[model samples]
Target: MDEQTATEAMDNFTAIWNTYTLEGEVVHWLACSLYAACRKGSTPTVGKGLMEGNCVSLTRILRSSKLSLIQFFSKMRKWADMSNLSQDFRLRMDRLERNFEVSTVIFRKFEPIFMDMFQNPQGAEPPRQPRSRKHRRLPCHISDVFKFCWTLFVYTKGLPPLYRADGHVSSDEPPPCVLERLCELHDGLVVEAKGIKQHYFKPYIQKLFQKQILKGHEELLTEMLDPQNFIDNNKAINREYEEYVLTVGDFDERVFLGADADEEIGTPRKIIQEMTTSQTAAQSQLQQHVEKSGSLAPSTPLTGRVYLKEKDLLVTPVSSATQSVGRLQSMVAGLRTAPSDHLMQIFKSCSRDPTESILARVKTLGQTFKEHYTNDSDDTPGAHIEILYYKILENVIVQETKRLHGRDMSVLLEQDIFHCSLMACCLEVVLFSY
Candidate 1:
C-alpha cells in the first residue's frame, strides 16, 4: 500500500483495533488494517495474493508481523504473560479515576462556586461566598486496583482452591494466580463496560472532554486538554494522557440548571413533591407490589472465532504426523482439537441425526463454562449459577442449542463465534470447558 493509503487506513481502524489490542498484541494489527484497506473498494484479488500496483504480498507481510514465541511462551507451553496486560491495567485504572470525577461534585457547591463562575446568575443571594477547599473524591490509583481485588479475594468462595493451588494464603504474599485472576476480572469488566459504553456513552463525547461544564480556569484546562502538553521526544505516544485532567476536580455545573435553579435545597421531581398532602387518605389506595422470577438463562457458548494467532501459541511435537492441525491449534489458538468422550458421546447418542446431537451438546457446554460467585448473608447456594449451573445435565445443552440460531444484540460475540466454530466444536470443547 502507498504511504498515504496506509496512514488513512490506520486512522480509520485505530479505535476499532484498539479494542483488539486490549486483548492481544499491538504490533501486527496494523498489518490487518493495511490488508483490509488494500481490498476496500479496489481489487478483485483476495487472500495472500499480491496487490496489483505495489506487487506486495499481503500474506508475507501479515505472517512476518506476528510476535515471536520467544517473547512469551516456551517451546512446550501453550500460553504466557505479556507486559502489555499490566501496562493496560495501569492505563485504564488511571483513565477511570478521571472519567468519574465529573460526577463527584456536591449539589450545594454547584450553585455558588461553579455556577457563579460559569453561568453568572442575576440577583443571586450567596453574598459573594468565601472560597473553601475540600476533597471531592478519592484518588483511584493503580494501587487501588490491587487493594479492591484483594478485598474481593478475601471473601471469594473460589479463592481457597486457587490459593491452595499456589500453596497457602498465609505466606509472605498472596497467591500469584489469584493476582492474575484479579486482573482477568478487571479486564473482563472493562470489556463489558466498553461494549455498553460504545453503545450508550460515546455519543456524548462532550461529557468526556468538554471544558465549559467543568473548566474552573481557562489556562489550566487548555494546558491539560492539549495532547502535546507533556510529551517526551522519545515516546511513541503522547505523554499528556489528557483524560487525567477530568479527575483534577472539575464537575458538571449544569446540575443547578432548569426548574430547580432557584430552589434552596434543590428542586424535587414529581415523585412525592406533587402529593397533595404528606399523609395520604384511604382514598389514595396503596397498591401491593408484585415481582416476577424469570427463568435463569446462562450465556451462550462462544464458537467459531478461530483466527490465526498474531503471536505464537501451541507448538505441536514433530512425531505426531497423524494428529490433525485442528488438534494442535486447540491448545491456544484454534477451536479445533480431538474430541473428548463427552463430545463423542454427544454425537454417538444420536448417530441417526447429528443435528439433535449437536444441539444437545451446545446446551450442556453453555451451562458448564460459566462464572460463579457467592455472598455470606443468605442460605442460597454459594455458586450463583447454583442448581442452574448443572441444569445442563438435564435441559441445559439442549436449551442452548435451540437458541443457536437467533438474533440478539448482546451475544454478538457468542453468535459470531458459534457460527464460525460449529464445524469443529467436538474437537474444541474439552479445552474450552477446562
Candidate 2:
C-alpha cells in the first residue's frame, strides 16, 4: 500500500483494537506489528484461521509472544466489525460530519468567547489570585478535547473496511486492529477527563451562581421568562407558518390549474384579489367595532385569515376568529405570569426537602425509561436513559440553585450539570462493562 493508504489502514486498525481490547500496551504493540505486516503485503490471519493457526504453523511469527496470537486476532476480528461500535458514537459522528463545515465556521467565529469562558469561568472578571495546581489541572476546561475525540472516534469507526455503502457490515474487509484500539483508548481517555471535570468544577460552578455575574437573580429570571421574548419567538414561528401556508396555497393552486390548463392564469389572480379585498373589508369593520368598544368585539373577524382543510379551503368565521384571538391572548397572559408561580412552587418544595424532589424526579425518569424503552428492541436504551437522567438532574440542580440563590442560575448550572452527568454516565458504563 502507498503511504496515504497505509496511514488510513493503520487508523482503521487502531479504532477496532481500541473498541475490543482492555489492555492498551499489549494491543498497541500487536497492532503495530500487524500494521507493519499489512504494509509489506503480508496479511494478518483473522477469525478461524487465527484460532486454528497453531496446528498448521508451529513456527508462526506471533506464537513466541506470551499472549496467544489466535486469541488476539479473534478478538480483533470481532471488534473490527463496523457494527461493533456503539450506536451513540455512530450517531454523534454522523451528526458531526454532516455539520462539519458549518461547525468549523461557527467555532472560529465564537473562538474568543469560548476561550474566555474556559479561561475565566466567572464570566465577568478574572480571579484575584491564581488557582492551586490541583485546581489548574482539572479537565473542566477541556470540552474541546472531548469534542475532538468524539469526532475522531466517529471518523475512525467509519474507516473500517467492513463498513458497506448501504451500512451493512461486509465480511471480506481486512481487519485493521491498531486503529480500532486507538479509537477505543481515545474514548476512554475522554470519558475519564470528563469525570475529572465534573469532580473539580462543581464548587466553581456554585460560586458563579452565588456571584450573579451579569444581572441580579430576579432580573435574570424575569428576562428568561419574559413574555416579550416569547412574543418575539412566536413572530419567527409565525413567519414559518406563513411560508407553510403559502406553499400549501401554491400546491392547491397547481391542482386547480392542472385540472383546467386552458383556463387563463389571470382567473386565479382575480380570485386572489377578490379574497384579499373581502379580507380587508372585514378587517376594517372589525377595527371600527374595536374602536367603538375599546376592545375586540365577540363577533369581530381577524384580517387575512385562511384555513386549509383536507379537501377544501375555508374562510374563518368572525366569531370563531374572535375566539381564536382571545385564546391566544389568554395563553400569552398565562405565559407572562406562570414562571414566577412555578418558581415559587419550586422554591417551596426545595425548602421542604430539595433532595426528596430530586430523587422523585430521578425515580420518575427511571420508570419512564423502563416503561417506554425496556421492551422496544429497536432502540438502544442506554443513550436514551443517560439523556433523560442528565436532563432531570440538570433541572433539579437549576431549581435548587434558583431556590437557594433567589435567581436563575442556569448560565453556570448548565456547564456543571453537563460535566457531572457525563462523569456519572462514564462510571455507569465502566461498572456495566465489567
Candidate 3:
C-alpha cells in the first residue's frame, strides 16, 4: 500500500523474471502465486493458479527434458525449504521433494495440487500421516485351515472320528492320542496365521516387483529374519506370529509326540483287540449301572436315596443318566477312531483364531509378554493381560541394512512363513518362562 514498499516489491519481481528462463520462471511464479493464496486466504482450486506462463504450462513445454524436471524440483524444494513456513508445511514440501526424486510421475502430477492444498488448507489443522507401504506376509489359506483342524483336535484331546479315515490316522490329520492329548496340555504351543496369501503373499506381486522391493521366493520366505524390523514389528505383527509358532505350533508337536507313545513299526492285531475290549468293558460297566433302574425303586431302602432323588430328579432323570453314559461312550469311540497325522499342523496354525477360550487366553498372554515389555497399568491391571492369554501374532520386518542388506531384497519383501516363525519364537519365550 505504501509507495516505497510497492515499488520495492515490483522491482524484486521484475529482477526474478529477467534472471530466469521461461521454464524456471514457471516454478517461481507458481511458488509466489501459491504463497499469496495462503496470505490472502483464497480457496485452493487446481484451476485458480494456472496462468499464461505459470509452472503448469512450463512443465508441459519441457515434458521431454529431464533437466527441466530436475530444475523444477530444485526450485520446488527451495520454496518448500522457506523458513517462514510452518513445520507441517515444511514436511509436505519435503515429501514433495522426495516424491519427485523417487516417484517422478506421481510427484509431477500431484505436487502442485498438494501445494495448493497446503496454501489454503480447509481449516487450520495439523497434518496427518501419508499413506505408506506395508511389508509383512500373511498366512496362506491352506495354512489357516490346517491350524483350525489342529486346534479342534488338540482341544478335544484327540482327533474326532469324523476327522479320521481308519483306526489310525496319518501324519496329515490328527496325531496319535498321546500327541493330541499333548497338544491339549500345550495347546498354548499351537499358533495360527491367516490372510497370508492375500495380505502378504498375494497372488499378484507386480507392485512390489515394480518397486524392486522383492527378490527370490526363498528370501521372501524369511523376510522377518532381520532384527530391526523385528523390534518395530515386535510392537506390532512380528510379536503375534512369533507367539503363534512358538506356543501353538509347539503344542501341536508335543501332542503329536505324546499321543503316539509306541513308535514301533507296526501296531499288532492283539494290541488293537485288547484296547477295543477294554474300551467296550468300560462302556458296558457305566451303562449297566446307569440303566439299572429307570427311577429309584419306589421303596428302595438306600440311606441317601430319598435325599438324592429329591435334589437330583428335577434336572437329571434316571433315563438321562443312561443316555449320558451312551454319549460318553460315543465320545470315547470317536476319539479312538480319530486320525494320528501331523503333516497339516503348519497349515492349521495359519488359519484359526488363537484366542477363543480360557486356554487360548493364557496362550496369548504368554506370547505378548515375550516380545514387548509388559504393559504398566494398575487400574486396567489385566488390560494388556488379555494379550498374554491367547496366542496373538506380531509381524515385523528385519532388514539387512548394512553389509549383507541390499544383496538380499527378499528381506525387504513379505512372506507369511517368516512372519509366523518370528511370532512363534517370541510367544514361546514369553509364555514358557525362559
Candidate 4:
C-alpha cells in the first residue's frame, strides 16, 4: 500500500482496537482486523504472509492461542465471501465505495457487526425477546445494595483532609437529610421494580451494622469521642497562656513604669524611691503651672502610660458554681429564641437539686432547642452550644449521682453510668452535627 492507504489502515485498526478494549476482548478483535485487512488486500506492500506473522507475534504477546487466530481468520473469510452475495452488505459496500476515503468508510461500516460476532464468538443462541409483562423486577441483589452502602461509608470516612474539612467521620458522615432522600429513592425502586416491601432489605442492613464494617477503627473512634482529649486540649491552651504571660509580663511592667530597671544603676528600693520622687515633683510642677494659669485646663490624660499599683492588679477567685452558671448563660446567648429562654429557666430551676424530673425536663428542652434552631437552616449550632449542652447534662448526672450516693461517695459520680451517659451524649451531638 502507498503511505496514505497504510496510515488510513492503521487508524482504522486503532479505532477498532480501542472499541474492543472497552469490552475486554482486544486481542481477538485485533486478530479479526488483521484477517479482514489481509482478505481485502488493503496492505499491498505488507503482504498477507507478513501480516499473519505479525498477528502470531501479537497473539503471543497478548497471551492468545494460534489456533484461535486461525479459527477467527476462517470465520472472517467466510463473512467476506458471503458479503459478495448478501444484498445488505452489497448496498452498504456500494454506498461506502462512493466516498474517496473508501478504506476508513468500509472499516467503520463493518466494525459494529464484527464486534457483535466477536462478543458471541461461540455463536450462542440469541437472547430471549422481552415479554409483555405488567411488572419487571430490578436486577439488584441484597449483596449489591449492602456493598454500595458500605462503599459510600468507606469512601467518606477515608477521604483526605482536602475533601474532609472538619475531618471527623462522625461529623463528616453523609447528612441524614441526604440519606433520608436516598432511602426514599431506594424504597421507590424496590416497590416499583421488585414489587417488594420498602423495608424488605432492612434485616440485611441491620446485620451489616452489627458486623461493624469499621471493626478495627475502635481506637480512632475513641480518640475522637474521648472527653479526656478535650480536657487535655484545654490544658494545652492554659499552658500556652501561662507561657505567654510569663514572657510578656515583665516587659509590660517595665514599660508601664516608664523606666527599665536594668538601665537604672541603683538597688531595687532606691529605684522605686527615685521613681516616686520624680512622680511627686512632676505633679507639684503641674500644680504650680495650673495655679499660675488661674483655671484648671483640660489635660490629655498622660497620653499612653498605664499606672498600676500592686493592690489594684490582684486576681479575684470565682466559685465554680458562679463560673459554670456564667458559662452556661454565655452559651445560651447564641440561640436567641423562646426555646432558649425556656431552657435558661429550666437550668436555673435545676441548679439546686437536678432531680430526675428536672433532668427529663432538660432533655426534652434540649431536643426542642435543636428542632427549633436546626430545622430552618443547613448550618448546625455553633460548637459552644453543643459543648455547653453536654456539659450541663454531665453536671446534672454528677449531681444526681452524688445525691443518691451521699457526699462521701461524690467521686463515684465519674464512674460507670456517668461515663456511659456522657459518651452517648457526645456521640449523639456528633451525629446531630453531621
In model 2, how large is the Cα lDDT of residue 91?
Answer: 52
Off by over 4 Å in 1: 1-83, 86-89, 101-274, 278-392, 399-434
lDDT of 2 at 302: 56
Give the per-residue lDDT digits (tens) of candidate 4, residues 1-434: 24443454466567654543222244444544443443233221334232211112222221332323224434434434533334643443344233313323333333233333233222233344358666443333322222233233322322233432222223343222233344353333423422221222222223223444322224223231133343342333334333332322111111111233222212232221113568989888889978887645435675333553454544444454445546555655554322344344443444343334434644565566667556533244433344555455546645654544323333433244663455456545444433
Top-TM-score candidate index: 1
- Model 2 Cα lDDT, one tens digit per residue, 1-434: 34554565567666654565333345434543443333223223555232211111211223333333334334334443442445643453344334433433333333333343233221333224356665332222243232332332223223223321333322554333233343353333545544433333322222323444212233222231133343332333334333332322111111111223223111221111113568889999989988888766355475323553345535567655656545534433323211244444554444343434444544454456557545533234433434434444456656555444454443433354554565457335423332
Query: All candidates' lDDT scores?
Result: 0.33, 0.38, 0.34, 0.37
RMSD of each: 27.1, 34.4, 34.9, 41.4
TM-scores for every candidate against the unseen true structure: 0.18, 0.14, 0.17, 0.16
Which residue pairs show collisions in model 1? 303-417, 304-420, 304-421, 363-396, 363-397, 364-397
User: Candidate 4 regions off by >4 Å?
Assistant: 1-279, 289-363, 373-383, 392-434
lDDT of 1 at 246: 19
Q: Residues 144-218, candidate 1, lDDT per residue (tens digit)?
A: 222222222212211123222222122243222232343353333545544433433322222323422322223
Error of 1 at 225 (Å): 29
Alpha-carbon shift of residue 30 in model 3 (angstroms) = 4.4
What lDDT tens digits, residue by residue, belong to model 3 across residues 1-434? 23443354345445555654333344344544333223223223366562221112222223322223345445545543332446765665455445334433322333233333233221233333345686544322322222322332233222123422223212343222232333344332322212222233222232233333332243233342243332332233323333332322111221221223123111211111123568989877767766875543433466465465465445556666556545433433322111112212322333442213323433454446534755545322232223321222211212232223224323222344544454455445333331
